[model samples]
Structures are given as C-alpha cells and as structure tokens.
Target: NAGVTQTPKFHILKIGQSMTLQCTQDMNHNYMYWYRQDPGMGLKLIYYSVGAGITDKGEVPNGYNVSRSTTEDFPLRLELAAPSQTSVYFCASSYSGGGYGYTFGSGTRLTVV
Candidate 1:
C-alpha cells in the first residue's frame, strides 16, 4: 500500500507561475501536514488539517493555500510563485494526533526563479 504519495518530485517554476503539490496517504490518519524545508534549514509547517473539511494555517502559510476534503488527501497550492518560495516540500501523516508516529512522503523539490 502507498503510505503517502507526493507528485512531481521536482519542479522548476518561473516567477509568477503557480502549481499544486499533491499529497495522499493510504493510511487513514486523522492528521496531515505540509512542511517546507529551506536549504540548510529545518522544516517549517506551512499548513495542517485535523480531518476532512477542517484545516488550519501553520507557522508559514503565506503565499500558499491548502484544502483537506477527505481523510486521504491534502493538497498545497502555491500562488504567484516567488524565489522566496523555493524549498523542498514534505507531506506527513499520523494517527492519534501523531502519537503513533508519522509516515512521510519522499518530498518535492521546487525551484522558483
């Protein structure tokens, strides 16, 4: 089974272009999160969802949007992509509010120039 899947493992975007990074988890976890890691930096939460139809903005939600319509899917949308948005995105999921540990996707590397 695919624990978690993220599409477009790598992408290059010209400034002002937009794209959606897709994430899906096979494990029926109640919590899902989007995190971005800058070069030589730790990951920062961009957004999260506790359940379907419930979403919350995390530490760095600016210039990005997210929607959780089902337990298995949470997609992140980049708006007016900018150089500042260049980073590697990771998607993770866990059950029981993360007490069971998380299953993370391979990650998507994005470059905005």
Candidate 2:
C-alpha cells in the first residue's frame, strides 16, 4: 500500500492563480497535516486535521484551507495564490501525536510569479 502520495510533484502558478495540492495516505492515520518548506528551510505548519470532520488552522494558514472528511484524503487548497506562497509544500501524517515522526509525501514545488 502506498503510505502517502502527492500529485503534480511540481507546479508553476501566476499571481492570483489557485491550485489544489493533493494528498492521501493508506496507513489509516488519524492525524494529517499540510506543511510548507521554503528552499533550504524547515517545515512550517499550514493546516491540520486530527480526524474525520475535524480541522484546524496551523502556523501558516493564510491563503490556504483544508478539510478531512475521511481517513485517507487531506487536500490543501490555495486560494488567491501569491508569490510569498511559492514554496515546497509537503503533506504529512502520523499515527500518533508528537511521538512518531511524520510520514511525508515527496512534496510539491510551487512557483508563483
């Protein structure tokens, strides 16, 4: 089973263009997260969902949104995408909170002009 996967591994966006960063997991994880990593940088939390039907904003949630209606999928929506939003977005999941290292998808490198 694929642990987690992200589509369109790379993307280029013009200012104001929107895109959805796809993410999914097959490990039946209950905690899913969307994080962005700048070039040669650390991961910054964007949004997260603890379980189905539950979601919350994270450290960097501006211009982005997320939903977790099921246990497998957690897609990140980028609305009114901006140049500042250009970064490597990584979708991750963990079976336990703060105890286990998150399983991260390869990543989606987004460039906004």
lDDT of 1: 0.94
Cα error, residue 23 of model 2, in Å, equals 0.2
Model 1 regions lying over 4 Å from their true place: none
lDDT of 2 by residue, 1-113 (tens): 88889987999999998989999999999999999998667899999998989999999898998988899999999999899998999999999856888999999999999
TM-score of each: 0.96, 0.95
Q: Which stretches of candidate 2 lie over 4 Å from their true place?
A: none
Query: 34-73, model 1: which lDDT tens digit per residue?
Result: 9999877898999999999999999999999999999999
How many clashing residue pairs appear in each of the predictions shown?
Answer: 0, 0
Q: Quote the lDDT for 99 in model 2.
A: 83
The residue pairs found clashing in candidate 2 are none
Count residue pairs with overlapping backbones in model 2: 0
